[model samples]
Target: MDRYIPPVGRWKLARRTQQMTHSALRELLKVAERPDMISFAGGLPSPDALPLARVAEVTQRILHAEAIGALQYGPSEGYMPLREAIAERFTRNGSPVRASQVLITTGSQQALDLVARVLIDQGSRVLVETPTYLGAVQAFSQYEPSFEQLASDADGLIPELLSPAQLHDVRLLYTQPNFQNPTGRRLPLDRRRQLAQLALETGLLVLEDDPYGDLVYEGGPLPPIHSMAPDAVVYLGSFSKILAPGLRVGYLVAPEALMIKLVQAKQASDLHTAGLTQRIAHQLFTEGFLEPHLHALRARYREQCKVMLTSLGLHMPLGVTWTRPEGGMFLWVTLPPQLNALDLFDAAMQAGVAFVPGAAFYAVEPRHNTLRLSFTTSTPEQIRRGIETLGRLVTARLSGLS
Candidate 1:
């Protein structure tokens, strides 16, 4: 008999599928899993920080008392109690939000996907920081928007640099103002106000993705840009960073008018975030377990950040530079101009250290002379060893040694 052919060869993929490529960071995560490797690549919370006991108790209580509803299909908007709880928290934080305005998602990543689906069209202008979150870029790219790189400095996005032309025909400004991913740069309060005012003046919508807002290790968190102009900014929050990421629970708060569309998009995406996980998150938030847990988490991450900073200071070459992040898991590193981070990856891998290169974080005009290191997952000793290994590689490269 003739060889049988599979129909997969004849199937045509959607144009959006072409934009979906494997995440460079995720690929590094595989290498990170090897026991001998010291990885600063993945943006992971410390395993020690997970509230295993509390989560176990809560999950057991729910399953014992409300098993049927918890396991059943849920409303597309989300579990109502959790939505109310989240609304109350945001309102207390200075952003007055209504429960009706909240839409729970599979994860904050799903929230990003939903926002892109509802807002972006082919050729839409999307403003993003120079080295923005790669995950957001990945989510937004599928919709085929034209990304405009906003100018940023060491501290993060410069709101003053936003010109009138940049706002013209812009669909949304996606930002992680609080301890932004890859760079670990937080926007100052003054800039937050400026950004809010700019959005209001230009009638631009801002997507404030604040997964790391609660991870503050120094000083305090500035009021969110969403709080400054509640109607103009769509805010996304997550339990992943502070709590466990395995649950895949997150939410977005939008003005009620726009929220309806987001809810519809979410329904089309996934009926709702899992009721069980939503309930678990809500119970943790309302029962007063989350705050103390966060306190412990902040202290743990603070020490990790300190260790990484101290190690980098002691070992890195004279021309090498890195951000001193007050909070958050990752920090950006700029190698000497002569050294390219991508070129050093293989050697670093062989040397048993792994980090995400800065080029993967960019939407356009990637800088090969940079990389990102996450401090949360590794121990202080591992961080010191990893940085020492990386610094040696960088030094050798600058000296024209392989």
Candidate 2:
């Protein structure tokens, strides 16, 4: 046994591998699975929302009629029919996207990786919201770009705060304008316009990630920044939210010049998205299953959001505040400055309630007195119970401070 030990250190991993860290949300997902735990940790869609029967039908039909295509190696740019379907949907949503401009990737996460690889150099200045999506930070970090946090508030990132000085040397600005993760803040219409204008003026390439755009609960869809500045923005879309995450199908639209490079990067990465999944996703789009499914998802999630809001209002101690998002799976909770969310995690876990601490969402300086609550997966009763438990812990902390 002793002789069997290999020279592990001699293997010599890449520098980027050293920089890669496990996602905090993914780590917390283990706690979320405990039978006794009421988890608001992962941004997971409800099991009820998954169109299982429909998916089965689509999969069977594709295998029967197009088995060869489904099983064979697909184009790196993706199945042309699926790409065209996504492009048409984007065009209907106010952004005029073309199939030629779309490049299908394994997932939106891969799209993020490709964008980072193409645009970022070592020490390139990349701008992000004050507390941005942790996944974006993780993806972009591997490229060794310098991250700069933009000023933000409850409404979301402020276009007004992006001064000329801040714009200097900024290679990319990543934003999730609609129903953003962690905070669940939708950038307002005016802010979207201003941001689009700023990107155009500064020649900044904006990566607009809009996986949750179709989850609107309270209002009509606002024009995407990509629509406002098509040339300056790269848009990422996914079926993971509206369809199913397991399919791992997502697409990105960029300027033709940029699309060429992205397609090359994708080819090197995975060749193409899974062929069977691409065929299944295309049917889900063209066979008329997506629209009604979105309606049902909106209604269900809207109700879940309401219940969580009510629970927070009823149970949270004074000085604890949370965002009331119009649409999205998650919301941000800011605890009293004296109480750190990270410090509260173990106790909350012990009490069978789980939520992600907010500091993980930040790209630069993190605010310790905050956390994120995902409302889409848990039931109304579970939400109330978990929030009550969390509230009690927070009260005890506040009492200790007093």
Candidate 3:
């Protein structure tokens, strides 16, 4: 008989791409389940904002009436009614997208992965903001692309930092233009136009991920970059933030040429987003239920944001800087250069609070001094208590070290 030996460890048998691993955010999800933990680690939408009762009602209606359509295999592009709804939204917002240009994805996360599959190849040069959405970075990493970090400020990406030579080889530029994750920085309208112009002039593709656009707490709305350079940008939007994450409905608006490729990639990935979910999303929209719901959500989130900002102002240690976003789930915090966020994470946890270290958001070597705090999931009281605890921990750490 052959020696009793396993063929190989799954990790060893896995493709080199598997070595990349999932995001730190996913890892934090495990910690978030601890009832004792006050987590600012995940970009979770508030449970109060989710239209749970509305979803249950619509879901029952769909099963009772259109069960066949809801359960049967659907088109890979998306459910037709859902696509039309998404297109109408874009048009109403002034982007004027066609339903044919939309491809429904399992989630905006899936949209990111599909774009990576279709556009990124080995050694493809991709440009990203220094501190960007970690999920996008992880999704694009599997393609083995070479990432170049773009410098950014509170106003968003620095267009001047983009060089002509860099543009020549860049396969894509990825940005979270509206209330960017981690940073909570919105790109100014002028910078958005400049980014569009650069992409158009250089023939570079832009992946504009705007999941947080609709969650604005207190700012004037700005047009999407795709609206300015429709031909050159691939825009990703999601119902996860405004509607509900459980539906997992998101969409990509791409040029017709690119849309075809993405649809094929999406088919290979998961066929299409669930028809039942799409139908439910359509029902919610068609019945005119989301507008007032969104208004309520904005009000609640704005209150939470204010709580966190006020707490930070009162408790944050000296030599720290943070962004005050007009609308969005998160705020980026930069600690003294001598401090490492990763090392401080445990201390914060011990103090009954948790947040994501900002280093994981970078594709290159990370900044050890930065961290991200989200205000959406926690209660206003929790935000205040958590920040106070975090401040105490920081003060203790600095005092002990000094």
Candidate 4:
């Protein structure tokens, strides 16, 4: 008898399912997971930074003391205590974030998805940065909104080019102002103000996705654009970086009017974020597990960043420029125009190193010579070795060695 393998591709599938493509970063991540590979690829917080003992302690406390509340189904808007905790933290900037405005989600990624579902219609205009976070692009693309990238530089997004004509029919403007993914560019104080003003003048809804705002190394925190233009912006915050990503705790603050629609969307999506994690996260937040933990994370990531920077300086060929971020896990690299980072990917793996090509982050035209390196996971020694391997590969490519 013939084997019973079915023709899976012949089955009818939804247009949306057919349209969806796999994430290149995820594909690369599989390769990076090998024991032999030293990956400067994933935007993973260091294991050393994760407060495992404290997390276990919190989990024990929640399970023992508030077992019913922790395990039960939660409101679609989120756990009230966690929401309150998030709202209080928002006041750190003195912008007066209220608990009423906060809505907890599974993750900030879900917040993006909910906002896109609520606000975007097919072909709606959505403004984004030139090299935005791939996750955002992936999340928003499902809603079929048209994307327009605003002009940007080392100082971050420039909304100066946001003319009145372009603002017509624009639904949302997405940005990662502090230590952006792939690029790691922090928007200056002036540009943040400019974006807020632009939103006020044109009524462009700003999605200020901030997962790394508190990880600043050199300077004090800049107020989020949502604070500057509360009515005009939707603020996203995540505990993924500061706390364990496994907790998947994230929240958003939007206008109450908009929050109603978002809550409806959240209800249809997954009912709500998990109750137990929210309770544990809230306990951690209120009991002061964050401050000392955050300090340790900053110290560890700072050292790793320093190692990568030094390695790049010593080994990379001249004209291969990279961003020097003040904080965060990632740094962007722009190779000389002649060398395409995509072409170098396989070679990098063969040489026992991995990186994310920059083109994957773009919503429109992509620069072929750019790539992103994540420094937080790898140790100083591994970073040195990985950079040396990558440098040699790049050099060989430059010299016409296949």
Model 1 Cα lDDT, one tens digit per residue, 1-402: 633433457785665676788888887788776888898988998988889999999999999999998999999999999999999988897778899999999889999999999999988999999899999999999898999898999878899989878798899999999889999999988899999999899999999999999999998878988889989999999999988999899999998989989988988888888999999998998998989998999999999999999999998989889998888898999987777898898899999999988999899999999999999999999999999999888888877853
C-alpha RMSD in Å of predicted model 4 compared with the true structure:
4.0
Task: Report model 1's TM-score to 2 decimal places.
Answer: 0.97
Model 2 lDDT tens row, 1-402 = 222333457684566675689998888897777878898998888989999999998888888998998999979999999899888888987888899999988889999999998999989999999799999999999888999998899988999988878898888999999989989999999999999999889898899999999999998888889999999999998989998999999999999999888989998899999999988888888887788989999999999999999999999988999999999898999998888998899899888888999999998889999999999889999999999999899999899989
Candidate 3, position 154, lDDT: 80
Where model 3 places Cα greater than 4 Å from the true spot, the runs are 1-7, 10-14
- Clashing residue pairs in all predictions, respectively, total 0, 0, 0, 0
Off by over 4 Å in 1: 1-8
Deviation from native of the Cα of residue 146 in model 1, angstroms: 0.4
Give the candidate order by descending lDDT.
1, 2, 3, 4
Q: Is candidate 2 or candidate 3 better by TM-score?
A: 2
Against the hidden reference, what TM-scores do the models get? 0.97, 0.97, 0.96, 0.96
Question: What's the C-alpha lDDT at position 324 in model 4?
Answer: 97
CA lDDT, candidate 4, residue 149? 83
Model 3: worst 10 consecutive residues (lDDT sum): 10-19
- List runs of model 2 lying over 4 Å from the truth: 1-8
